[model samples]
Target: MGKPTGFMEYDRKDNKAVEPLERIKNFNEFHTPMSDKDRATQAARCMNCGVPFCQSGMMINGMASGCPLNNLVPEWNDLLFHGNLEKALQMLRQTNNFPEFTSRVCPALCEAACTCGLNGEPVSCKANENAIIEYGYANGLMKAKPPKVRTGKKVAIVGSGPSGLAAADQLNKRGHDVTVYERNDHIGGLLMYGIPNMKLEKWVIDRKQKVMEEEGIHFIVNTNVGKDVKAETLLKEYDSVILCCGASHPRDIKAPGREAQGIYFAVDFLTRSTKHVLTGKKEGWVDTKGKNVVVIGGGDTGNDCVGTAVRQGAKSVVQIEMMPKLPDQRAANNPWPEWPRVCKTDYGQEEAIAVYGKDPRIYQATVKEFIADKNGVLKKVKLVKLEPKKDPKTGRMNMTEIQGSEFELPADYVLIAAGFLGTEDYIAKAFKVKLNARTNVETKPGKYQTSVDKIFTAGDMHRGQSLVVWGINEGRHVAREVDEKLMGYTNLP
Candidate 1:
């Protein structure tokens, strides 16, 4: 610990963001960087506990406890405390390959599971990492460190998202030839499209990709294995193929007026908006200019839709959730360390609340019908009260609608951010891979092996749709599996 009494002396102070009114004017990042003095103090707050729960990315009571990549939180924090930024960057890069991406969009699990969080606020792990990485980049400390020797072994990684990227990075570090395939014109799959610019700028992903390229990882854009290129060809050409396409099938809301023209999926809306930002074209896309927009579903994607609509000059925005509202604090039975199922404002919610008088999310409400205009453009949404239901046979919980409590609201565009169901079918079918009941790629515990010999799966493709941190974990483990399969014994860490 840099300062024995730092946590007590220095109260938690994080990076301040740009005011809502001013931030909504552009699509650029608004969070002002924390001063070096403030960041150093925050870094000093790391207690460096005996167990270091901040670096112990293990599951406790079915929830992620701390850093998913098991980042050396306390060590890096101490390094930063002494202003040894070089050592801090090296320690940060040891585990997390892309701290920039996680530092921005990730829901800092490290903070929630921090030992300090039990009594007082936790150390500013996320903010500190952000400050450190930005510091490294600004000071020209980060550079391309390619492998020393080539292993001559080739790997074809499907899906250029976090999982695939992490796997390729690890394998490349071991001197293996890696080629990443991306369907989109850009390299960073979800990061390039699903996330917005205000949260994670494109340049962040671009910089990482450039570094990986220098490390001998080849990224092939506009080449899809299932459609553009054959998956069988990849299996034959590469020594090993890793599937990481992700659970991309967006769950749908099959309600009245489901086929309305302006009504779209949340993924589609996010992807289009991001593409527009990257391409600088807003024509033919879902333009929220002076239009009332209703985003169905209350997860991160729904909130993203709300924020994107607001930035596009949405006249009004309302986010709907079928689940009942959660308590502001942890429930009685729910103790510390569990992922707090509480109602808290995210960036999107804060932006919406700053613009609209109140929070944009409305709980215990669901859409029954989407009214459309004569031209088939979505005009408005018809909503009804929602209640919890118990199954008579299985005793499973479900949602039931309340009668005589239906209402309609104006909406020029409706975005369904109901989340994903499972991985896409093409790659799975091409490889003849088996899926579990949830439709995710089937994999046994403590194993990354698949039914097809020599082939492996990871990330959301093998597991269900989950956090990017989990994807990184799966990638690292899968790289170990592939390495073991290749040369009997592996030395990757």
Candidate 2:
């Protein structure tokens, strides 16, 4: 609970962003934090709903309706409302290990289920979380405090993304000897390479890494599990292997001339861009200077591609989403108290508007083919309009191309940000874990024991591509389960 009358007293304040014109000039984070006082007021707007569905993490229509971590939202909100910053930070860290990353990129399911959002706008739960985390770090309240006992167990984590980091944090807290093996040279996977630094500064990740290192969690960079280091060898060396390698497979679009030189996966493109930004050099990086770029997807990765392309001084940026246009207001199916499915401009769209004079997204598009030159460089794209149709068996709506709706677009470069298709092929193949119907490493929910007795899988590799918060949650939960299975009982967070 927050201030009893806070919801009546204050309307929710919005997050501030740098002007699109200014932000597009360089690849820097455009978000500007709300003042401490303002962020507190925003937190105070959390209504004292008797049900408190915002933290329930319940299934409404078979979709997650709130924070999966079930964070102590109300307690922290009330703590912040009373100007108890230190107490709020303590309450926040009890549940979430890395609020910094989630604060920047999380979808904020909690805000979607906020009671205040039913009739009007939601409380700024996301911003409030960001505020407390930032405040703790600024006041030196966030630092390393390693566990007191040594369990004498050695664990090898195969990834350094959110899930891996969360697992490592939990295991190290149990006094397990933990060494994280990151394939890339950098420790943070998508956080360092896939995400642009402006939205999330590299230093924030570095700061967290320093704290983890201080807590005795060893991180080995540039050591890939399947390549540089053998996967089987790791499984034998560690007490138990937790596969949090994440779903790195980028979904590709098949069409004529798709093998053109200018085409690349969205993950690869974003990774290369971040590499250049991190190193302060443009060599071997994906350069968009004076090139016509077409990104095929409408998700966050696609938006990130647009923003990065704009910053790289591309001639033009066009994004195509296969789905039909969304409604300006919530559809009847998505009523109040549920996450509203409505049209709203994201950061990349705002940047596109500033540079191109309009938003760069076209809805209901299907690629017919990619037209390439003799040298195998893309020159243009042939497209067709799509209409939703119901499947005969599943009854689910499928996109169908309309006859005579074909057209062509000038696309010099194509980036496929079509999302992921579950875990990669080799890691799970090495472990010989069974695949679920969705091709993800199969396991019962909350029971991460893989087909192999000592092996376990969690995060996107097991659950399918999802938000970072869920990855952290799964990793923490699996670490606890593994600890309990190894010993008779355990204490892990």
Candidate 3:
């Protein structure tokens, strides 16, 4: 440990975000980073526990409890505290391929499982991570390092999201030729489009893409594997194929007036908003100006929809959650070390409250139908309250909509952010890969290989919708497997 008593001496300090009202004025990242000295002090708070559960990457009580990348948390914290920022950055990159993406968007499972958090505030691991990576970038320590020798093994990665990028990075570092195929017009599948510019600016993705390009990884955008390029062609050309196409089939609400003009899927809405920002054109954009926006499903994506709508000058915003509100603090069953099942007010919700004079979330509620005008544009939403009850036979908790509790709210626009189902069917069908009942690609338990020979899968396509950090972990893990398969032995860490 850099300082045995550092945890006792330093209180946790995180980056300060610009006030919501001001930040909402524009779609830009608003977290003002702490200075190098202050960030080092925050890193010093790492107690360097004997067990260090912060990097355990274990699933406890159905939720991840630590850094999924198994990042060397204590080692990097010690390095950072001692002002060895370049070393700290190296230690971080040892496990995580993209700290820049995760530092900005990840929920920080490490902090939840931190030893310090058992009794007090956790070490500012996420902030420290962001600081270390940002310092590397600012100091020119993070530069393209293309492999000197080629293994002559060609690998095709079918998505350009975090998972694909990580896989490409690792495989390329191992002297394999990697090509990433993105169906969208732009790369960074979710990062480039699904996320708003406020949370993760497009330039950050572009910057990383530039570095990856310089590192000799090939990228082919606007190419759908199943359609534009034949799957058989890739299978024939590449030594191995890894599918990182994320779980993109959005789950939809089966409510009336679903075809209303102003109603959109959350992904579509966010994608359009980001495309408009990047292209500076309003081709097929859903304008939310001076309108009442009701975002269905109170998840992070729903919250993003709220934020995006507000920035688009929506008159009012409401986020509906079918489940009951979680307790403000961790519940009795959710003890320390398990992922905290408590309420969290995200930046978008904070902005909604500041602008609308009240919190935007409506818990234990769902939309009944969409009320549309004669023009078939969404005008309002009929809502109903829900109660959770154990099914008599299955013993599963199911949301039961209460009768005689229907209500209406003005909603000129309705964005369904109900999360994803699985990877689209065409990609799996093209490769003749099996899928589980959930529509996710079927791989052997604890394996990334598919039913087809020389074909692999990772990230949401393999495991279903999850965090960006988990995607990186899957990508790195799959790279090892592919390397072993190719070389008959592997050296990838």
TM-score of 2: 0.97
- TM-scores for the candidates: 0.97, 0.97, 0.99
* Root-mean-square deviation of every model: 1.4, 1.4, 1.0
Best by lDDT: 3
| Model 2 lDDT, residue 247, Cα | 87
What C-alpha lDDT values do all the predictions have? 0.87, 0.86, 0.93
Worst 10 residues of 1 by lDDT: 332-341
- Pick the winner on lDDT between candidates 1 and 2: 1
Question: Least accurate stretch of 10 residues (summed lDDT) in model 2?
Answer: 336-345
What would you estimate as the lDDT of candidate 1? 0.87
Candidate 3 lDDT over residue span 1-493, tens digit each: 8888988998887799999889988898999998888888888889899999999999997999899999999999999999998889989999999999998999999999999998889998988899889999999988999999999999999999989999999999999999999999989989889999998988888888899999999999999999999999999999999999999999988888888878889999999998888788999888899999999988899999999998998999999999999999888899989999999999889999999999999999988988999989778899999999999999999999898999999988889999999989899899999999999999889999999999999999999999999999999999999999999999999
The reply for model 3, stretches above 4 Å from the true place, is: none
Instruction: Quote the positional error of residue 346 for candidate 2 in Å.
Output: 0.6
Screening candidate 3 with a backbone cut-off below 3 angstroms (N, C-alpha, C), the clashing residue pairs are none
Scored against the true structure, residue 99 in model 1 reaches a CA lDDT of 89
Q: How close is candidate 1 to the true structure, as a TM-score?
A: 0.97
Tens digit per residue, CA lDDT, model 1, 384-420: 9888999899999888888899999998888999989
lDDT per residue for candidate 2 within 1-493, as digits (tens), equals: 6578888899888778878888888777777887878888888888667887788877688678888888888889888888898999999988898999998988899988888888778888888898899999999998789999888888888888888899899989988999999889888778888888777888889999999999999999988788788877987888888888888887889898888889999999988898898887887788988999999999888999999999999899999999987899888898856766777678888888889998899999979999998988889999999999999999999999999999988888899999999888888777788888788888777688888878888888888888888888988998898898777798776
Candidate 3: C-alpha lDDT: 0.93
**Model 3 lDDT-worst window of ten:** 6-15
